[model samples]
Target: MTNAVTFKILEDIARDLSSDEITFPTFLDITFQVRSALKDPNLSVEQLAKLVGAEPLMSAKIIRMSNSVALNPSGREIADVKSAIVRVGMEAVRTVSFAVAMEQLLKSKQMQPFENLSQRLWEHTSHVAALCRVLARKLAKINGDEAMFSGLVHDLGVFYLMSRAANFPELVNDKAELHALLVGWHDNIGHALLSALGSPESVLEAVRDHETDREISTVSNLSDVLYVANKIANRSSCWRDPELDGAVDTSVLDTLFDAETLAEIIDESEEEVQSLKAALGG
Candidate 1:
């Protein structure tokens, strides 16, 4: 794609977002429904289970997630959606809904042309999400589940941009142009798309700032946890190619945890990270 075409696409996307006309694929219907239902404070576990049951695949995935070692350290198991919802809590259910939706979106026919990129994106997302959960609990003393959810949705803008880019064969065929476009616009586009999806302000903030490098004495908040997790994941990120994109700067990590402590944290949490990734369909 030429400079003119790229600029035109960016301009069009900006106008659409400013007007609150963000486009989402049809597969997101279930996610929207689940999120809308989750907003009802009075909704009981049974009610939510009934709604989840309407989608058999998602219900099964939730059950599997509830049974995953990351969520269920106990050897106990749950067989049904209601029990799964009770075990994982509503926030986790929301995360699962998005996980399922993203997996489905990646497998869709329209996205087949970019299958490799989509798979890499999902792998990066899963790695960051699991790291966020572990770092939040072990270092930040915050809600690990919430941190994981934030990590999972942090790259939502990239997904949205890819979905739109599929319509332009010229742009889609040029990897360099496509990568540059996604890098330049994903953060703001993700924030807008999350806002349109009625995401929480805290989550929106984390998504918006995950890529910004900053000095930190501690991983104290959700944003801090996400930012650190993203940096760690970038070591094995889909967006990074050492030969092409150059080496990643990991100096800030030293300020957060000494070499040994950080290594220990990652080593101890390796199993949990892989378990959570599997649970989320990585």
Candidate 2:
């Protein structure tokens, strides 16, 4: 927890980043397969369904997401993976794959030591993702699914760092010290990790700049939507501990939307957000 230890941890991460040797959990195997499958333009719905069905948990989450209010506004429901895939689309299925992977990673024995932090991080991730979807659709006029995916993975670096921190018992037990290290390194680490994962350029850009403050009169791009969404979500972040962390400043939102409009958006999206969060296993 001392400065020397923090420097050493940062150095270790930097070495991994430079060498492109960042490690991912075993649970991400399914997620990688799903993403790889989705990249094939010739992949049929049935084929994707078959692939998804191979992983029972991912398949179940896909079906649940397809039935969520965010994706399925109608009351009608479908009971099969194929139907679910058709309803949610390929991108959404990819998002669900990540949702399932992260959920599993948190439950994995390796991450058990940081269960509390993992849960908090997941909750914050869900909130930001839901907000991104809503904000993208209602304000940015961008693809809601893409925005949601960006939000979900924006803090991916933090998760990876926590996983790595499992090797450092002292760091694991010191919440304040752990939080400081994560804040200092997550953004750059996330960008590198996403790049290594072959994430879309737009998504990589959003992740890289989500924490960077900038003046914007409106939400016009994915980065803008993510920035606004991240700020808003941080108002009640999982990383927040009054005794360990300081209050998050969201005043930049005032430059984008008036108080009434922002409140209205939050109010209207509350139900959908919660629904999507639950669908994502929040």
What tens-digit string does per-residue lDDT give for candidate 1 at 1-282? 356667887887778777846555576778889888988989999899998999987898899889888889997999989999999887888888888888888898889989888988899898888899998998889888889999999998888788778888888788777877887789888888788888889889999998787898988899999999888888767554454456767678888789998889889989988988988983
CA deviation > 4 Å runs, candidate 1: 20-23, 242-244
The true-versus-predicted C-alpha distance at residue 8 of model 1, in Å, is: 3.1
TM-score of each: 0.94, 0.93
Query: Which 10 successive residues of model 1 have the least lDDT summed?
Result: 236-245
Error (Å) of candidate 2 at residue 37 is 1.5
C-alpha lDDT score of every prediction, in listed order: 0.85, 0.85
Quote model 1's TM-score: 0.94
Question: With candidate 2 superimposed using the best TM-score fit, by how many Å does residue 189's alpha carbon deviate from the native?
Answer: 0.7
Write one digit per residue (lDDT tens) for candidate 2, span 33-107. 888898898999989999989988888888888889998898789789999998988888888888888888888
- List candidate 2 stretches off by more than 4 Å: 20-23
